[model samples]
Target: TAFAGVDPGVNESGSYAPKSVPTSKRGSSNLRKTLFQAMDVLIKTMPQDDPVYQFMDRKRTQGKPYYVYMTAGANKFLRIYYGRVKEYLSVLPDPS
Candidate 1:
């Protein structure tokens, strides 16, 4: 729901719908650099060895640092977010 560098070589602008994968913020027709920047914020907010990173790196452990390897980490976060959204699609079945 924000805009900025969400990737290294991009400055995309658009809502992040879970309809497809966001490999690179750059060259994306609807993405911007801000998106990458936004993800960078998450990197700053969270710890270097946070469980999120663990979840992201669960498949494989490269010699690169977690923050430095944000491409895979962010991709994992996105996938995790998608799963959470699906798991909690409704809050108490809409008590309006």
Candidate 2:
């Protein structure tokens, strides 16, 4: 398992971080869609402004409906987060 600064626990569940999620009668595709919609609405917004952002910061998302939504939101946030970090790091010269 890959080690993430966000969480140190080795998730044996594989690359599918969303596996902890269990789809309702709506199923995976619907859940994925829900996640996408939430991410689009939430990722750019401030944490205090959105509940999903708060959940991702806690890193304790459940596998039910809320979890799926937050996972999607976190997914979008992390992508943007990584891009911002990379952009910042690229501006600096390497010490080595």
Worst 10 residues of 1 by lDDT: 1-10
lDDT of 1 at 78: 58
Across 1-96, the per-residue lDDT of candidate 2 in tens digits comes to: 011222223345655574342323233455455545666565466457555576554553454455445554555555676788999999999999
TM-score of every model? 0.42, 0.36
The total number of steric clashes, by the backbone 3 Å criterion, in model 1 comes to: 20
- Residue-wise lDDT of candidate 1 within 11-54, one digit each (tens)? 34586445334444344434434444645665567565766646
For candidate 1, what is the lDDT? 0.52
* 93: Cα error in model 1, Å: 2.7
Q: Which regions in candidate 1 have their CA more than 4 angstroms from the true location? A: 1-35, 54-61, 65-68, 90-96
Best by TM-score: 1
lDDT of 2 at 64: 41
How close is each model in CA RMSD to the real structure?
A: 9.7, 12.6
